[model samples]
Target chain A: DQQVKQNSPSLSVQEGRISILNCDYTNSMFDYFLWYKKYPAEGPTFLISISSIKDKNEDGRFTVFLNKSAKHLSLHIVPSQPGDSAVYFCAAVITGGGNKLTFGTGTQLKVEL
Target chain B: DAGITQSPRHKVTETGTPVTLRCHQTENHRYMYWYRQDPGHGLRLIHYSYGVKDTDKGEVSDGYSVSRSKTEDFLLTLESATSSQTSVYFCAIRSGTGNSPLHFGNGTRLTVT
Candidate 1:
């Protein structure tokens, strides 16, 4: 059983527009959520994260909103650029689970010029 | 960018052959992880280590084994290669502090023929 799920396989947006990627989880024990960006042939890089206590966290053009009640989270990128095109993964971890992460399938984001 | 390096970036081997991938870290972090990324499967942990000679299995550890004789190195070995094991492998490191995000090495692409 997949604890985390990224329902959308891909998303496309125009440059300067907003791109939103969504994820869901079934495990209530997950207390931390993170987003990672991956380029072709490269490992994933940490992007932004939101704790269970916070509903939203923003950094630069990236913002992550967590809805604990719905067991869902979303990543928004405003003014999306070409460089933002890549596969984005959502990961969740239980607070005391030794930082072991459970990952979603992933969503491929493409920002067009 | 956490000073993690995965050796043998690409490898192709015949079935039943044994293969080992190496992950080296210069950050001196106490946590190291091995993950495999495949199409439609995002990233799944194979194994992880918390300290020297301390290792644990992750969600997908059935066909793999890991060793951590030192804090700076973690090794993942496949006793016998199989076509089902062909995938890209990544190594990640994190501080011992809980809730810390992970930093990853480039990756190693392994193909079993």
Candidate 2:
């Protein structure tokens, strides 16, 4: 069974608008959640993360909200830029145990400029 | 972009062949991981190492093996290749910080036919 799941395979948003990507996990042991962005021919790059303790974390134009009770999380990009168009991955990891990441299939975000 | 580097960025081989991918790090981080990215499957963990000669299997470790003989290098090998294993593989590294992000290498695209 998939511990962390991202039901959406793709999402589209207008430029200078808000882009939200959602993810869910089945493992309650997961203490940390992260988002990674990737472009063609490149590895994934770290975006932002939220700990199980806090419900949300923000960095620059990116913000992540975690709802532990629902095992759900969302990534929000305000005033989404064209450069933000790419595949976004949601990953989760349990604390104390060596970091074994469980990733969601991904959401291909298209920011129309 | 982080000190992580994966060698042989692309490879094509026939079935039953042996293939090995290498990940090297200059950051001297304590944790290293291997994962494969496929269409419809975001990124599945193959294996990870916590220290030199210390390793463990991840969610998807079948038909794969890993070894970390030194702190700087971790290797993933497929003893016998199969078409189903064709995918883009990535190597990642992380420190002990509970909130730190995982750094990634560009990736290696392997084709088995």
Candidate 3:
């Protein structure tokens, strides 16, 4: 069974617009959520994260919001640029669960000019 | 850059053969993980190591094995290759500290025919 799910397989947005990616999880034990950005031939890079204790966390143009009651989370990137086009993966982890991360299928984001 | 490197960026092996992928880290982090990425399945952990000579299986550990003999190296080996095992493999590391995100290596693309 997939503990984490990214319903959207792909998304497109115009430059300078806002891009939102959503994810859901079935495991209530997950206490931490993270978003990672991956280029075609590179490894995933950490973008932003939100703890279950907080409803939102923001960094620069990236913001992550968590709704623990709904077992859902979203990542928002404002003023999306061409460089933001890539595969976005949402991952979750249970605190003290040996730091094992469960990841979603991923959403391919394309920021168009 | 988290100083993570995955060797053999690409490999093609035949069925019944053995394949091993290497992951080296300069960070000396306490946690190392091996994950496989497939079309519909996101990143599923095969195995992980918490410390030198300490390891555990993850969600998909049936046909895989892992070894961590030193602080800087983690290895994933497929004892017998199969077409179903063809996928991209990623290695990740994280510090033992609180709520730290994982850093991933570029990845290794393995094709079994």
Candidate 4:
């Protein structure tokens, strides 16, 4: 069984629009959540993260919202650009686990011009 | 930018052959990890090292082993390559303090024929 799940395999949005990727987790022990963006032929790059104590965290154009009760989190990109098109993965880990993350299957986001 | 490097960006070998992948970091981070990225499975940890000579297995550690003799280098070895083992491998590093996020390398694509 997967501890983390990204139900949508792919998402597409037009330039200057908003893109939101969703993730769900079954493990209640997870207290820290993160999002990573990956490009073709490259490894994932850290994006934004939110702790269970906070419901929202923002970093420039990227924002992550966490709903602990629902065991869910979402990553939102405002005014998505072509450069924002990439596979987005959501990860989670329990506190004091030493950052051993459990990642989602990932959602491929395409930002059209 | 995270001072992480992965060697053998691409490799193709026959089944039953032994293979080793290397990850090096200049950040002097205390934590190192080896992860495999597959289409449906997302990124799963195979092994990790908290310090020199200290290592542990992750969620998916079968058929794989890791070693860290120095703070800057971590290695992952597959005892015998199998067709099912074909996937992209990534190396990541994190600082020892706080809940630091991971920084990943470019990745190594391995194909077992």
Best by DockQ: 3
TM-score of chain A for each candidate? 0.98, 0.97, 0.98, 0.98
> Each candidate's fnat, in order?
0.75, 0.89, 0.89, 0.77
Query: What is the alpha-carbon lDDT of model 3 when measured against the actual structure?
Result: 0.95
Candidate 3, pairs of clashing residues: none
Better of 1 and 3 by DockQ: 3
Residue by residue across A2-83, what tens digits does model 2's lDDT show?
7888898989999999999999999998998999999999999999988898998999999999999998999999989999
Ten-residue segment with the worst summed lDDT in candidate 2 chain B? Answer: B94-103
- What fraction of native interface contacts is shared by candidate 1? 0.75
**Interface root mean square deviation per prediction:** 0.8, 0.8, 0.6, 0.7
Report how far off residue A7 is in candidate 1 (Å). Answer: 0.8
Stronger candidate by TM-score (2 vs 4): 4
Each candidate: chain B TM-score: 0.97, 0.97, 0.98, 0.98
Which is the better candidate, 3 or 4, if ranked by DockQ? 3
As a whole number from 0 to 100, the lDDT of residue B75 in candidate 2 is 96
Off by over 4 Å in 4: none
**What CAPRI class is candidate 4?**
high
The backbone clash count of each candidate, in order, is 0, 0, 0, 0
